[model samples]
Every structure is written in structure tokens, then in C-alpha cells.
Target: MNDRDVMPAFDMLMEELDAIVTHLNQQGAQLMQAKEYAQAREVIVKAEAVLAFQAKVKALQEEWVRLSVSSSKKTPRKKQPGQRVMTTMLKQGLRTPNEAFMLPILQALVQLGGSGRVIEVLDRVERMMKEQLNKYDYESLPSNPKELRWRNNAQWARLNLVQAGYLASDSPRGIWEISEAGRALVLEAKE
Candidate 1:
């Protein structure tokens, strides 16, 4: 019987279970809204099962931690910023593709405020996305190309951010400001 052989697989399963619980919770919310109590209840029961499995996984984590640390040869371990960014973003309620894009932009917007820096960052991001993305329109922009791109992406991001309570916008000034949620997201990204 090899205990170490099963440790990584168990850890992977724990992560999957955690993600499943989050998904079930989200789906359960929609079901509850639709008044489908039966479906929501089923989801809750399944989530409980996952939680039970995780209790076992947590006990196994002790063994895995010892194995990983002892085998590393190096004393102090360092994690990269990108890995930290992913971990923090995942810890928050960002579990969607649109959220993957929108959250970073929201965070950036929150940091770079009404100053010219905000426009610069937006321009840089829009340029990168436009270059990377195949189908993007350039015509609908205002006189400035920077304004054009911001007009497009910021407009879409504005609706989403506002709905999520992360941003405030004034149509007359074409300025966007971060709300409390946006600040929280930015801090999460920083961490």
C-alpha cells in the first residue's frame, strides 16, 4: 500500500470538489429564484457529500505537505506573482470567462482613477486586446483612437461593472469611477 501515490490525486479531487460546491451554489441560487426548491435541495445534498469527502482530504493534506516540503531540497519556497494572482482571483467570486476579462479591467480602472493614467492604461489594454482579438471594430470610436477603443470596451465593461456594483459612470463626462466592490477587487488582484 503506497500512501504517497494517492496524495496528489486526492488533492486534485479536493480542488474539484471545492469548485463543484461553488458551481452548485451558483446553480442553486438560480433554481431558488425560479422557485424550484426540489432541484435546489438536490444540489444542497450533493454539496454536503462533497464537503464530507473534503474532510478526509484535509486530513491527507498533512501527509502531502510533509512530502512536498521534504522532497523540495530547498528550505524556503517562493510562489510567483502570476500564481498568487490566480489564487487570489479564484478565491474571490470570479468564476466566469467574462469575469476573467472584466475583473482585471475593473481593478485597473479602480487603481488608475480620473488622472490621465487611467486613459493610458485603458488605451494599452484596448490595443493589446484588439491586436490579439480577430474581430474588433474601430469605426465607432470618437475622434481619438484611444477614445474609440475606450468607448467600445469601457462601455461594455461599464454596464457589467455597474450591474455588479463595481463602477460608476457619468455619460456627460465619459468618466468611470470605481465603487467599493471595484476597490475590493483591485486589492484582491494586488494580493
Candidate 2:
């Protein structure tokens, strides 16, 4: 490829990498405040990517410096650090049906106790949630894969308990013991 074509693509990739890095460095608390789980998940992935890109950039710079010195060419220009080019944190995610399905189940899982569903678990769930999770006024959790509303306080307890890996429901039958993963979620929540 011609130098002209090569340079622009590299420049564009660098610009994108820079933009990703800026986004990734946001405070952990700010990331948690994300309104949706999917969005938060994207941010975490992007943040990790940013860190990766920075590592790549650093490695490239080191190699470039070595090559330039060997070839007796002037060092390539370097962009100043910490300035954004693309400049936006766009809204994340499509409200697709599949996401809609998994979301409620996940949110419901979060509500029920996730690890354990004792009184303390319920209390913690209520507190972590910005909204109330009671029977009468329980708002819809995010939709899951099947478009089930994941509605009902019964869901609140059931999903969370199930997700915590404790208490697998046989549906109209009964729940079994909590799994180790369930125990972990409960323990983490408590901590």
C-alpha cells in the first residue's frame, strides 16, 4: 500500500484508540450509575479495550523509536496526550428483543437476593435498587430474552434467589440448595 493510504488508516486507528482510552478512565462510581446493565457492560468492555489500546500504543512507540534510530530518519511526530478527537459518549445499545428478554431476568435476579434471600438479602436488594420492589408498586425490571415482564414480587424473590445460584426452582415443584456461585453472589453482596 502507498504511504498515504497507510498513514491515514494508522492515524484513524490511533484516534479511535485515544477516544476509547478517555472513556475507559471514568471513575468506577460513575460507571456504576449507568441506568442499564447493558450500557454498564459496554463501558466496562470499552474501558478494558482502552487500557489495551494504550498498551499497544506504548509498545508501538517503543518499536517506532527503535526503527527510526536504526534507519536514521527523524522521529515521527507524536500527538499530545489526553485530548479527545471523536468526543462523545454516545447512548449505548439497541433495545433489541433478545436483550429485553435477558434483562428482566437479570434484574429480577439482582432483586431476589442473588446469593441468599433472607430478610437481610431482601433489605439489601431494596437498598441497591433506586426504586421500590414491593408487591403493589413493583415496577417492571428490564425485559429478558422472552419478553416476559419478569413481573410480580414473586419473581423478585425467585429470580434473585435463583441467580445467586442458590435455590434452583423445579417450577410448581420446589427449590433445591444454593450453588457455590449463589453463595458467592450473596457473600459478595453482603460484603
Candidate 3:
């Protein structure tokens, strides 16, 4: 179903989940009061099932967000007569290669001793890209005026690296770090 349909379903699911949680809580409380150990265990098992369903719903929401972000598109603006176009390194589009940004991000993390804030890493990646890749500029997606498309690619690369066990996810908010595997990957790539 489309988002329009899914949204209502999501809301309904949330309501159902809330009701289930309330029921579970009440039942557990009652069982505790009666000191019914066996029934309490059953309630605990039911609570686990509720948690599983909640997790599924959360996963669905996350997937929706990812798909929506990646599928976003923007139309290019017509340049005025005197308007100079930005650097011609690569044209803007969904086709921009993310691989070019990955190594630079990894290298930036290594230079920072394998950990840093996201924005700091992003700036480092940009500088490295300009110097090493000769990528003077990248076009921004239509949905964003101040953001460059390659930056998004870099973020995706970071996510992929995290999934590949090359980055750690336990850092502070807005912070990322290279795992031991990432350092090894960098060394291997160099060789």
C-alpha cells in the first residue's frame, strides 16, 4: 500500500499496540497481586510477543523513512543570463556515485583517530574530495538548496560501512567511529 494508506494503518497499529500494552500491564499487576506465579509467567510471555510486534512496526516505519528519503527528487532551476554555473565536476542527479565519498569519509575518521562528530567528518570529507578527487563541487538535490547531494551519498556510505562492521554504532549522538575492521579495510585498500 502507498504511504497514504499505510499512515492510517500505522496509526491504527499504534493504537492497537497501546491497548495491548495497557492490557498487559493491568494483567501483570493483577497477577502479581494474586501471587499467581504461573499466570505471571504467561503474562510475561504475552508481553514479549507485544514487544516483538512493536519492533516490527518500528522496522516498517524505519523502512518507510529510508525509502522516502532515497526516492526524493528535485528539478533543476534555469540559470539566468549572468548566473554562472557551479563547478562542473559532476552533474547533479540520483546517479551520483557514492563510492567516491566512502574512502574519503573513512580516511577522515582515521585522521581524526578513528572517531569524530558527523559534521566534522563531513567537512573533512568535502575537503578531501576537493583535493584528492578534484571534485570542485556537487549539485544539491532539488529538495534541498543548502545541502549537496554527495553529502547524502557520504552519509549512506557511512550507514553501509556501519552495517558492514567497519563502523561502530555505540558512539554519542552525531558521532561516528571506525571499527578495527574499518582500519583493516583502509590498510587493505592502500595496499
Candidate 4:
């Protein structure tokens, strides 16, 4: 039989086994009432076949479940590091932060004439983030906390983008600007 047939056979056999046992109990009682001891022994002997069938069906069902579970466990999943980080960050919704800050930060620096202090850039990014909030890209907080989690990720995004030559850092800690490379990136992305 095909696997589909085998799966249903497990449930069908158990049901049929139950009906057999019920019928056997009634037959055994009737034989006993008639004081037919030999016939009652025959009834018990008849039930042995059904009982054996039940044992075999039960074993088959157990084996199916065991194999199904083991096969599922054998398969493994792989994800990129940034994708993994984003997944973790999204799960921290209502508790932590966003993976949505990078692009907005880039756009914000460009809007500010391709340069701004870190705090000013962050402020512009936050406003843009709020405008996009209805998109449900992030979880809402009770209040805009002083320490926004996405803001922290934005800083990390800035450092990484800078290293990648997308942005340039000035000598002072908070000042930043989009590099010519960063301008090209923004232009390319717009297309």
C-alpha cells in the first residue's frame, strides 16, 4: 500500500479492533449465561487473532511517528549573519529594537545637505522612522524612551557603512557626512 493508505490504516485498524473487542465481550457473556463453558473457551480463543492484529497495528503506528519526527529533525536551516541578527532583533519587539534604521539614516544625512552632527542625523532618522511607523516595520513602545534600540543599531549601521566607504567620519565624534561613494549608492538605490 502507498504511504497515504498506510497512515489511514493505523486509525482504521484501531477502530476495527475496538469493535471486535466489544462484540467479543457480548458473545462471551451470552455463552456464560447459557452455561456453555466449552463455547466460552472458544470465544476467548477467537479473540486472540484480533488481539494479535491490534499489537501489529500499534507497532506500525509507533514506527510511523518515530520516523516522521526523526526525518524532520535531520534537516538543517542556514541563514546569513545579518539576516540572523535582523530576525533576533524583530523577535525582541515590544522589548528591544529595529533593523530598519540604516537606510533612513543614509537618507537623513543626504537630506541634511549630505552632512550633519550625529544627534541631528539621528533626529531626522527618528522623524522618518515615525512617518513609516504605520507600515508595521517595528513594534511600538509605551513612550519614545531616551535610549531607543533602533538608534543604537543606526550607530552600528553608520560605522559599518563608513567602513564600506559609503559614509565619511570627521575628526569630532558626532559629525558625519555621506561620501561621494555614499551619494552614488543612494542614487543607484533610487533606480
Candidate 5:
């Protein structure tokens, strides 16, 4: 069955389990009042087991949510030879390489005084590289149709920059910042 069908079923199961636990607790209390200590202990132990199972199920549900959100953000690239050939054929003379965004991104951050919001940085970078950007760059990405291809390339470039230590890895979310090394590289380039 699909997620929509299974999710409600899981919810219903959890609710039923909660009711069962409540019943067990009430039964244990009644047994305690009647001085049946061993029976009360057994009921409490069963309730604890059910609670533990519920905890595990909740953890699994959380993990599933995390995985689904991450997977939906980006499409995975296929390494098949046929897919590679098709992509190469389709992309001929169209988009700029990811590296093309590096200098502009660093420059944009520098201009913004070391850090800026993602959209602001990208806007500045776009103005800087206007002539270099091609028609294909303006098109939407296949993976995320709402995002432009060049913006996605720029984001990939930012990821590479972070990996190479040219950008700050611990910067606040939605803000892009250049590192000291990145600034020095820009200075060295100017020399």
C-alpha cells in the first residue's frame, strides 16, 4: 500500500496502543487496591513493553520523514553510459561549468562585506556574469523545475567551495560567506 494509506493505519495503531496502555495502567491500579501485587507488576511490565515499541515506531517514522525530505530536494544522477551520452548530447554548448560561478560568488560575498543572504549573493553574481550566462542557464532544472539551471549550478559551486575551504562551512543557513582564504585568493588574482 502507498504512504497515504499506511500513514493513517500507523496513526490508528498508535492511538489504539495508547488506549491499551491506559487500560493496562487502570487494571494495574485496580489489582494494587485488591492487594494482588504480582498481577499488578505483570500488567505494568506489559504496559512498559508497549510504550517501548511505540517509541521505536516513532523513531522509525522520524527517520523516514528525514530521508524523504532529503531525497525530494535533489534528483540523483545516473552513471549509466547511455544516460551520460544523452546528457552530453543534450547539453552541448548550453550551460557553463560549475567552476564558472566560483569567482563571482566570492566577489559577490566580498562586495556584500564578507556575507550575504543567498538570494542577494546570487543576484549580484548574476549581474556580474550576465554576458557569460547563456539561454540554457535561464531554463529550469530537470530535478527541481522551480529553480533555474544556473542557480542550481551556482549552488553546486558553493558546495564545492565549501569542500575546498574557500567558503565558510558553519555559516548560518540561507547566508553565504567567503572565507579568509577565499578573500586572499581574490587578492592574489588581482595582483
Candidate 6:
């Protein structure tokens, strides 16, 4: 099966696993209410095991997405002068793609000493990419009217970076940190 098909299946499995864990927790709570301490402990243990398995599945899914993205990076295409001009004009009207945020984020974090608050990193990234951002990027998102489209796209890019092992998945909320792989990527680019 293709990546798209596999991803949805994995998502369904994760949802089912989450439901199982919730049910197990509820059963454990009921057992506790009945004063069946040993049964409650067993149920809790089962829930923990399911949670661990869920984590493993999530890791595998993230790895798959990372591999897919890495494999799908396209080589630059050759075009006639007219086509090139048209492409440039078209690009200016379109919002920046999420992949474009990866390096900027890593660079911003490195400049911040490998970690910083989300707002700080985003601000740095904005300054770095000021010339590249287009008017479309400045518009508000439909789902979140208070948030700009570019900021929402940047947050989604952050999620991709974390899944790809370039950002820390376990960093405290509101903080963004680069991983060793992320640092290596930036250094490699410099060379």
C-alpha cells in the first residue's frame, strides 16, 4: 500500500489504542471504588502497557513520514526563460511551503543557543524570512481567525520537524529546542 493508505490505518490503530487505554483506566477506577486493590493494580498495569505500545506505534508513524519527506525532495527543474519568469511570479502569489520553514527554524534555534520560547524563535525566523514572505502568508487562517496563516503553517512545520527528529518532541510547552540531528543538519549546510 501507498504511504497515504498506511498513514490512515496507523491513525485508526492509534485511536483504537487510545480508546482501550481509556476503558482500562475506567475499569481500574471502578475496581478501586470496590476496594479490589489487586485487580485495580492489574488493570492499571495493562493500561500502562497499552500506552507504551501506543507510543511505539506513534514513533514508527513519525519515522515513516520523515522517510517519505526525505525521499521526496525534488531536484531543481530546468525551464525556459519565459517559464522561469512565470514561475517566479506565481511563487510570489503563493504562500511559502512548510519545508521552507525547516532550515529557518533550525537556524533560529541555533542562534538562540539551541532552545528558546516559541515566540522568540518565530520572531527570529520572521526576521530571517522577511523578504521571502508574501502577502498571502499575512492573511488570517480560516479555522483560527486570530492567527496568521504563516504562523499556523510554521507551527505545522514545527510538528513535521519534531517527527523528522530535527526538533525535540518532549520539550516543555511554549518552548522550542533543536535536537543534535538538527544542529548537525545546520552545520552540514554551512560546509
Local distance difference test values of all predictions, in order: 0.55, 0.43, 0.71, 0.65, 0.78, 0.79
**Per-residue CA lDDT of candidate 4, range 21-115, in tens?**
65565567657866998998898888887888889889979998777642223344566654521121222233222235656777888999988
- Summed backbone clashes in each candidate are 0, 12, 0, 0, 0, 0
The TM-scores, one per candidate, come to 0.35, 0.26, 0.48, 0.42, 0.53, 0.52
The collision pairs in model 1 are none
lDDT of 3 by residue, 127-166 (tens): 8777444332365744456877777768877775775566
lDDT of 2 by residue, 8-96 (tens): 45554665565445434333323465465666677777778777776887677556555543333456556567643332221222111
Give the residue spans of candidate 4 off by over 4 A.
1-99, 131-146
lDDT of 6 by residue, 61-134 (tens): 99988878432445656876545221111122267766678789999999999999999999999999999998
Error of 6 at 110 (Å): 0.3
TM-score of 4: 0.42
Evaluation by lDDT, superior candidate among 3 and 6 = 6
Q: List the residue pairs that clash in candidate 3.
A: none
Please tell me which predicted candidate would have the highest lDDT against the true structure.
6
List the candidate numbers ranked by lDDT, top first: 6, 5, 3, 4, 1, 2
* Model 1 C-alpha lDDT versus the unseen true structure: 0.55
- Candidate 3 similarity to native, TM-score: 0.48
- As for candidate 6, its clashing pairs are none
Which of the two, 2 or 4, has more lDDT?
A: 4
- The RMSD of every model to the true structure, in order and in angstroms, is 15.4, 17.5, 15.4, 29.3, 21.4, 17.0
Candidate 6, residue 161: how far the Cα is off, in Å:
0.7
Best by TM-score: 5
